[model samples]
Target: MASHRKTRQHPKALKAMTLALAGAAGATAFDGTGQAAPHPTPAQVKGRVDALYQEAEVATQHYNGAREEAGAARAELARLQDEAVRRTQKLNAAKAELGTMAGRQYRSGGVDPTVRLMMSADPQRYLDGATVLERAGSHQANAVAGYARRLGSVRQVRDRARTTAERLERSEAALKRQRVTIVRKLDAAEALLDRLTDEQRRQMSPGAGPAAAPEDPARSGAQAPSSRAARAVSFAYAALGKPYVWGATGPSAFDCSGLTQAAWKSGGVSLPRTTYTQIGSGPRIDRSELAPGDLVFFYSGISHVGLYIGDGKMIHAPHPGAPVRIAPVDEMPFAAATRPA
Candidate 1:
């Protein structure tokens, strides 16, 4: 159920593709001297597949984070663009007003006050006109200054918009690359899975051990710190058996962070889209201090997350081919935990 926009091959199609690739995986490789390479044991294949799945999950997290950032950047860029347009309009209006002032002065024979006084038939009348001209000139000066400031503001907004636009472009490119990497890793992992027998595949699958409905936190002696936490824990339990979709956060499927975010949302606490960001969603807590509904992160990169459901166990989507299910909190490397209120 782990789906991506670009990769929508059904699970059955994926299985077939993997079986085809497994044939190639079993094919003997030739060295420069044409010697046959040794085939990998099922154990080695499982190790490689597990590593590939982890790598894919890391890439998926990066993609999710980049997507979140891109969304924000796009909104910021739009706001900056609107600001620039408004500033440009103001600058233009100032310019037009300054131009109109200059035109009026030209129509009135824009000559020096001293020359106008010398040529005037009535010198007192010309003096009065000069005072009015001086005031007009001051207004024009103010208009020019205002225009300069508006122009500067427009430039600043434009510069910021340009910078944000560039950042969005780079983030988009990175997301594309990360998407490709994830797809490739998932494909390879699936092929490796096909190389193993059903028993071997079950042995290597995530949440393969005793996956069942989680116990009630209150009854299991893992009391939630608050009603909100209890709601999140309950939401996670309801999501059990749903498929793991790399980019999905849904009623039917989810990725690791997606599951956590959705569960927390049901608790009335908004969480970020990726594990990296969710790590900072609330104050960090020690593993010993972990409570039901707390988010438990895994791996050094914080690429995976789970909703703690009490009794030292957590419910998570795990990896592809796994469903939303219960697993030990210590199943993977413990990176950190957070209690989002």
Candidate 2:
């Protein structure tokens, strides 16, 4: 009976032994003797990091091209800022030189829109200085042209700066994230070895961690204007409330260049009518130290003009689509800044 009972239990005993063997095999089934993922080599991490760096390089190249263009525009913009300061001082000086009433009377050879509106006794009086109106119209046209160019330049600079910043931030984050993922993977792999023989742990651990890739050249190349550039900023405060003209060089009434030309004239200098011709007429002052009476040039050929008063603003003929205006340096997307003394 005892022998028969042991025979009946033989199948169960065999099944238990088979189950134990299968579990043991499963535990060692991985390429390693542990049930964990494989650890990657330094070469693999380097390969991935290098690929990321390549992408960053291409992005940086694009950034560099854009940055170069922006540099020119921003330089001009800085000049404009400088002009604004000068204009303000001039305007204040003019105000002090001629009190409110006298100033109004002086401008009322009937130029300013505000004064003209006050003296609108004859609606048809617009034809009185008929030739002057034509000049005003021309001034307006030039102002419009200059402003359009400026707007484009500003947008380009703004966009370039924004994109460059984003590129650097995103690349850094990606690199950091990559390192974090590698660390986590390594930890998991290490945990697997924790249950292994000391020999197995030694084989898996590579002491060195992932390295940072080289930075993109584009990010390295772009530099903002120097502090000297900042000082060159002069703004025309005197041009405030000045009458806008299509084209009349002012004793009163101004087109865009006319305003700039006229303002400089107050400082006792004359600038060319069109901004294009003005480019060659003056010495290109380093954008820093823009002085009162200095003519600020705009556009690639210098087709727009403003008087540098100081602090990144300017008084200029804004546009025909608008009126004679005081605008910020950033308004014109300045191509090149030159001050004609």
**Predicted structure with the largest lDDT when compared to the true one:** 1
Candidate 2 Cα lDDT to native:
0.47
Q: Give the alpha-carbon lDDT of every model.
A: 0.82, 0.47
Encode model 2's per-residue lDDT on 1-341: one tens digit a residue: 34555435588898999999988887776656766556655445444443443333223323323443444555655665555555555545533432443356567663445333323465335324333444456543333333333434455555665565565555555545544543454454444444555554334323122211223322423231333222222223434445544435665556555565555555455555555555555677666655444556654534456655445545565432234444556655476656554
Q: Candidate 1: what lDDT?
A: 0.82
Report the C-alpha lDDT of model 1 over 4-110, residue by residue, as the tens digit.
Answer: 66856899999999998866656534442334676677779877987898999999999998888899999999999999999998978876776666667668879
Residue pairs that clash (backbone atoms under 3 angstroms), model 1: 2-245
Per-prediction tally of clashes: 1, 58
Clashes of 2: 58
True-vs-predicted CA distance for residue 300, candidate 1, Å: 2.3
Q: How many clashing pairs does model 1 include? A: 1
